[model samples]
Target: MTIQLPTEIWWRILDYLPSNKVKQLGRVNRAFLEKARQSRYQSLVIYEYDKKTKRRLKKIRSSSLGHYVRSLTLCVQAWPASDLIRWDGQTGDSLSVVDRVRSLFDSHYLPRKTVALKKKRLDRRIELIFEAMTAFEHIQEYELIWEEYDQDCPEEFIPEVKFASSLMTIFLSMLVISPLRGTLTKLSLQIPTHIALDCLAAADFPFLEDLKVFLWKSQCSRAKDWDILTGYLGSENLAKFISGLSSTLQTLSISRLDPSINLDRDFGRVFDLLCRTNFPFLRSFDFCTRSRYLRKGTPSLDRFVRQISHSVRSLKLSHLAYDTSSSSPLHHLDHRSWISNVLSVQGLQTRAFSSLTSLRIKDGSLSAHLADLSALLTSVAHQLVSFFLEDNLLTLKEVETVVCSLSHSSSPLRYLGIEPRDLAPDTFDLLVCAFPGLRELSLSFERFTSSDDDVIPMTEEDVRCMFPNLCLDLGFFCFGLMNTAGATADGIICLRLRSAVSLEIELCLMR
Candidate 1:
């Protein structure tokens, strides 16, 4: 009297169970094992290349579970402490070239024997990672992360940048030539450097749709030396990579872009390439860069905004203003030359974001060029659906100006986010009345706090007072609160207001 169920029904039942439960069921019988493969192997993340990882890779390669793998995340740790220091110009140290790293200002903290052994171990780990990569056949999303490692010893400061460069090149080559190349649709590379970009230029993803590049702080600090280290720095490499995937790429986001030789000369080349080649499917474009000043009339930058004037639907621009006091040669350039060298939206009149519906502006607003910012706002005011402006706080007057511009839109905006200096008692009512069709609203309030209790409970009460009808939803609010006495951010409270309005209240501390 044994009951029989179809494999599909078993799979459906397995999907409802927790992952741990599914694994437990897998051990019950062969039928259950087959049904659980999808749950167990659908996504995998390898944080290290140790013996356990090696065993998992062996099992994957030996079984049919390889076909079930769709997403793979590989995090390559930074250089070891031994790799950081080198006793260069020392005779008969028995240091292998494979483990040889750039000298850390003539430091000899680690013994030569220790360096050699660690280098050998690192080589073995890298080999294991390469082997693990081959175990997946249908990987559709691959994320390669270069995790940051702390430099404990002051003497252990030098990095294996060159070795990392070569490793990335080989990794990219393996990825593009593998069976998963055609299946891959999303690729996120967390290794931020000119070398990474150069490696990217050498490969192509046939079906890639989403690409995200994050610039690490460590990498950002060394941007000035990238040209000398990598032996080349230019936007051409990035442009070439984009051109290769122009047809299939749908989303492109480059964050924390540091101004360097590669970013300075033809900073707009990457943007301009996206336009010239014409990414028909491109819908979202996000670019954030740190600059000392706005370059008013740079042709490359001007042409870029104009070229993509009609295609992008989501645009996010973050201009992190660098301290003008910093002594960069570009800062000393004459007014005219400065005007000719940087990207400026001072006279943007063509409705550059004509097709845009969602816009996010953070860190530095184009407030300095009021006329241009106003003009730009007016042009896109008619069609914007969601808008978020934060980091750079806006005055009440500026907030009113923004609302006035957006109020004219034919279609009501569904979402609005802003940080205002002072919140009047009637601010909530004013916003609710202004955007009748708004479904979600986000506001940031700054307050000085001496303790967590002072920040949390009082802020919640303040929120309740501001939007009394939304207090019930505050019960389930996920608050990211800071407990420090003098923390800048107190907490965030999410609330549901009325029938459709969703509110996100952020509590920040004033400096």
Candidate 2:
């Protein structure tokens, strides 16, 4: 007896199987193999070190499987130092394996697929791969990842050395070739800081609509080298890079290796470059730091705030703090001036976040720059609809002021998240009154015991009387509750009574 299954069911089952297993199933029988080789399995990955596997992949690329593959990733392991010195010699065992792997990609069997090439060797292999990929007529997305080598390596006897050197050369070649620029809409490139500066200064990606660049800093070096490297990434280079991009870019994210580097004047230059560029279609911008340094003469937070306030619709500020130093004056007039500039009334109007709807401020406790932040928020309260102040040092008065200000705004705010440390009973009551139309609320509070008299004395009846038509999120407060009742006009109250008081209560009393 033969059993017939629906096509949809068969595809669904195949979806759960691993790619290697799916490839095996395709080799099971002609009928099963044909269906398995469909476009549903379009993504392919070829590794250079895996000789037997890549050779088989090459065969598949030439067969019917080639027509179905839409996305391909090429990962070649970095050849060890021993392999580098032996390159001039006759074809060794490792070199032969590398050749076999390179042949598969060089064949150009699946030219239409999106290609991701990760290089472990910096040599001719990379150039060959790019040359082959360029032949494809319908490639759309391309990504390149290379191991960053900044310091001179000590002598080693490891195999695959030649491959590693080759990989580096491949990465350098990409900067000049610019093959993936015009066709790619979304591009992510992980480049060394030195090469990143070079690419920023020289290359232009006209058709790139979304770009994510991770610039890894070189190994710590002398001050002169740092200056030279940073000077290459000055405002001019930044402007050139942005100018080269298509005016249709919708999202831009610029990040630095060290949060301390973000405070450098070069960061301000990059910001200026972005502003000068024509990104009229841009809707989202994110600039973040991994940590903060309070070095003297560093660009203040106000400069960054001013740069992004106009065009960014969603903003996130994280890991802010002043670098500790005994030599540098902790309380300088310039520091005060910077703070004043960030909170300046004139700057607020000039860079009013008129388009801003979502704002997230994290790690404010370490930074003593709350005054400027308040001023900034006060300026843009008219347009904000979703505000999140997480893990910040906000007093009850400041919390009440911000909430009241937002309530007075004509904008329709639907979501609000405030830490519990910033709230008192009076402030909490003020929040409900100010944002009557709130749909979601998250509050984080300190430890609360059952015996504590200062607990929010909110009964089910009180909740029903207060928020008759709204959803209540009491999860963050850790308020212990027993009987929570929900009532309707019919006079019957649906009481959800928890038998015992637990550590936390998440009550949604629907009326």
TM-score of every model? 0.71, 0.61
lDDT of 2 by residue, 14-87 (tens): 87887667767655565456567763435554444333543555565465455554444455333332333232
The Cα error of candidate 1 at residue 282, in Å, is 0.7
lDDT of 2: 0.50
Report lDDT per candidate. 0.62, 0.50
Tell me which residue pairs clash in candidate 1: 295-342
Candidate 1 local lDDT, residue 135? 65
Candidate 2 has its poorest 10 consecutive residues by lDDT at 484-493
